[model samples]
Target chain A: MEALIEEPGTADTTWESRLEAKALIPGTSTGVAFKLWVGGLLLVLLVGIVAYVNQYNNGLYVTGMRDRISWGIYIAAFVFFAGISMAGTLMSAILRITRATWRTPITRVAEAITVMGLITAGVFVIVDMGQPLRLYQMYLNGNWQSPLMWDMMAITVYLTSSVVYLLVPMIPDLAFFRDRLPGRVPHVQSWMYGTLSFGWIENPPQRRALAKAVAILTVLIIPVAVSVHTVLSFVFSTTVRVSWNSTSFGFFFVAGAIFSGVAVLIIVFAIVRRRYHLEEYITERQFTYLGYLLAAMSMIMIYTNATEFITKGFKASDDDLFAFRELFATKFAPLFWFYFFGGLVLPVLIVAFKRTRTITGLVVASSFAVVAMFIERYFIVVAGMSVPLMPYEPSSYMPTATEWAIVAGGFALFMLFLTLFTRLFPIVAIWEMKEEHETRVEVAP
Target chain B: MIVDLRHCDGCQSQGTAPQCTLATIEGHLLPEPMEWIEVYESPLEGGGTQFVPTPCQQCQNPPCVNVCPVAATFSAPEGVVLIDQDRCIGCRMCMAACPYDRRFFNWGSPPVPPEALLADYSMEHQVQAKVGTVTKCDFCVDMVRAGSLPHCVAGCPQGAIYYGDLEEDLATNGKTLVSFKDFTTNNNAYRLKEELGTHPRVWYIPGHGEAVGRDPHTTGRMPTKWPWIERAKGAVTWKR
Candidate 1:
């Protein structure tokens, strides 16, 4: 039994110590680069806040959204962020369940993104509404049959579980920060660590309890995550619009979630790796592995796009033809082609080629995927609405300056969350990586 | 439910729309600015033209009601769909879901006329005069409850629009009352986009721009005037 344990203690312990010594060290201060990045985001966010205030005061009239195009960039951004958030559960829980060894160092980055993404996604939905306070009215006078109600319920469930999923793994790490960082940072932050750590002493019983909780939560969150993505797509599919009323939408959206989720995961991974200089933890192998995932996702996305087009193109309802023409031939052609070529095609080519499978290539590819997926969401919503359900002339939806400012604010807020998260806590899951090493080492209890 | 296209030539002769839209806005003082009925001039395939006057289909399975998160829009017991502007959170999901494009939103202050001030608000006779909410053709629910034809049915100058009690099998175009089943069957009336299973109660009796002396090549449409612009000098009103 002892011999069956695969711990070569010397090699394993040295690696474990290295991870502990370097990876756990917080960036010394808000460095000039960090300050500049945050300051820029803050400026954008402030501008956006002003725009949002103006929208509230002046009514939705400040935006270009007419009755014809009721939804605009805010709803689009909601879908984009909601889909991107799946990276957390996808990277952490699903990969953990599958027992992927290489996912350990990068899971925290994914989970942090999930938290930030889900929150910002919800924020955009509020922004889209004529009255943000009506969100509560929806809950109070809830309609069981409304897809919007279902969407709200699904988001609440998913968000709760995601927060738990994010926090559970961070407990021991929080305790670590609590014990290690108080002397180094300000008193208020130190107090925060102490309060959140929940006295995690890491005794065998406590450790077992947390492990059990994490395991249960991991199993619990997958369906919830799937539901969040599906329900959002349902908001469109359930509508009577010919282009959106397809049965294939749920599966298509889930695929899109994974595609964008993995793309964002790679981009975040690259930034963390570069900024923290944790080359050893986030390896070239990680890039290669993610490249394979990205390629598969690109293929799936392209296939879904093609299927959506072919199925609609074959019958060619007048509405379908009009939308298809707009999507493929005219107004939206530039955006459609850019996403097809730059987001889908370029990503596939980059990931498939060994030379371009480097971290830089992966980052570039993921950037295209992220931006294009955002546009895809925008296209799906605006294009769907752009076609007047009646024979009335088709009206165009262009985002107003206010809308653009709010969108920029949303992006800045998301980055601000990640930035603040990294400043206070280790961006990598410290305890989990150590645990993995310990199990491999088979050290004495 | 049947529009007899053979007898109807959209408003080519009348010089105005099925005027129920004017009646609705003036009657309800609604802020949603909904035209209870709308007229469309669609080009026909054989180099002719057609007239499509859309009313609230009052679908058996309403997409608007189901998508409204707050139950702001709902179907009444008699099958006419309605919106409660008071309860509406202004999410506009109802607007998005209505395939007929019958729904309208109050983006800002609804322009109200002096006459509409002090109008009692009800779900059926809405002054949705609220700043942010959805409103649509309610099938003149208030008027029907008062034992009257829908405003549109009464207002159409050419007597083209019809109102009916489907359950009772009676209908009227203001001038003549007839059997709902007989009139539809005789006219070969069909619901718009019946393939979608919306089961819209409003039926088209078919027209090739011929009724009211329509000219297919003319491409003329009824001009929609908001009606209040002709107010007698200094009519007192409420704004907000």
Candidate 2:
């Protein structure tokens, strides 16, 4: 609702001048709004920690999960955050690889998002464990056959690669900040920037090496990101539970990750742009392009859902039918409907229709997509686990207040990381801003 | 083990009273929903019914062992699937992978007697259950290694549940010792959910629970109890 204030979309100022001035200048914007946002996040974080501590004392007995339904909201949140993390890196990689010149404004923002997304997502995996301290055993006695190991490997690879990918593009910017921000920034920060700058002399060979490293990294990240989500999907699909066992799972998960990833990136984009007043650089065209991508992903999700239902339903496996019935018509029908309509149908309409492709409309649609995708994951985990394998009584999981508190903590941490990320470094891609600045000076005298 | 449901009843023997569930509870002091061995009502094609004395199938390709992330559950040389409680992180992925749903997690500190806690913990025997780790029927492997019949097999009054050595081609049901190969082949015994390709260790000759005195019209699933844990006193868990 705060974003309802209209943007000066076609602001008369050109991007080059604005980019040179504001791009390298670090934001120190703190007001009632920023204070309130951080306060709310900290309060939620505190509450979440207290709730988690209580759960640690009582065991998972305090949660809604039981023997019948083992996994719950924590695992689902892990998947959601993993999917969102997959978005920024892949899209940025795809854009870079495909030579999309207009990606200059938000590439750095996307990479930062990927970093936070993976960190938060990885934390959820540990939180889900009943014996988190025994996590090191996974290193010493890891089973190669288990899908969980594949996920661990994929995430480890992806997180490291993402950090590198994020760092690669920032070198030139680090040098820019090192040179430009000495008077503007605190002495320690200036020193830190100089240390991170890596002694880039801007010679042709050095620039060429940086570009080559970036090009290689951009190409390398997509597959790792894709594999991370695909491997995560295997954790569910590898099980003999017919509801979870499906051939289409890999494709479905990868596609869903990208779809949800785009939605999250859009949300992040809106927040960063509006908060920092980057209207001159971010522009309406960038939103429309992302909107189009979102529209396409929405269609793919609908298709994936259809394919899953058709193949799984037609098999006539009792477990599958029971699970499908549980999701489509029984206790989980409302969530299923919301995922189908609110997630897929509404997003498609919002993005496809030309007049509604405005920033506000896209933001609204993106919010719906994010929430609905989360619900979709919740349904897959909870509803799939609800049906009994041996035809005993069907069991249900209703997350306790403790689970809700932990979930709230996860979200608050996500927002907190994102809020702090913008402050720690230049949110704008400084190297690109410098490029534009030099080019403008060359053209206009 | 092969359970011949045709001859077995769900309850303890009338005179001796040593059914598997009771013996297991007495030995391990397992909490609620942790009956290592249980009886389920397996309905028949006809109007009649029978009780299946269900225990861990101990599959050669055990899904529980294969899916455990930390390798907590490992296959014993004697073909028993044993869980290493010391290494178990209690992720519960194995529980989901199990088609038979035989695995159980210790929700909290399990109720055990002071005498029970004094015994040394053994991965081979699962003597000391942990709060968050998973446990299940280990086929009484230690007892088997000690050259004795499992508590359930020796206790069934009808001599229905048979313990066998497949490599040795011998099986016994307390009163009767028969050829392991011939007993299954002759009786048309089959493994449960044969389509799953688990290559299970246990086989069954299916029937209604009638052999154990179940009335087809009235009886359904055989009742299971967790004597150690009290029923929910307040907020009830909705178990189907």
Backbone clashes, each candidate: 13, 7
lDDT by residue for model 1 (A138-174), tens: 8688999988899989988888888888887888888
CAPRI quality level assigned to candidate 1 from its DockQ score: acceptable
Interface DockQ of each model: 0.46, 0.61
- What would the per-residue lDDT of candidate 2 be over residues B1-240, giving only the tens digit for each residue? 888877765653343222677667666656655767767655567665566677888998988888888889989888889899999898889988988878888766665655556778898677667777889898887887888888788767777888988899888887889898888998899998888889999989765445666456554543555454443232122232
lDDT per residue as tens, model 2, A211-245: 89988888888889888989999999988887788
Q: How displaced is residue A390 in candidate 1, in Å? A: 2.4
Candidate 2 Cα RMSD (Å): 4.3
Native-referenced Cα lDDT, model 1: 0.81
Candidate 2 ranges beyond 4 A from true positions: A1-17, A24-26, A433-445, B12-18, B209-215, B228-240
Clashing pairs in 2: A393-B240, B9-B212, B49-B208, B49-B209, B50-B208, B50-B209, B51-B209
TM-score of 2: 0.93
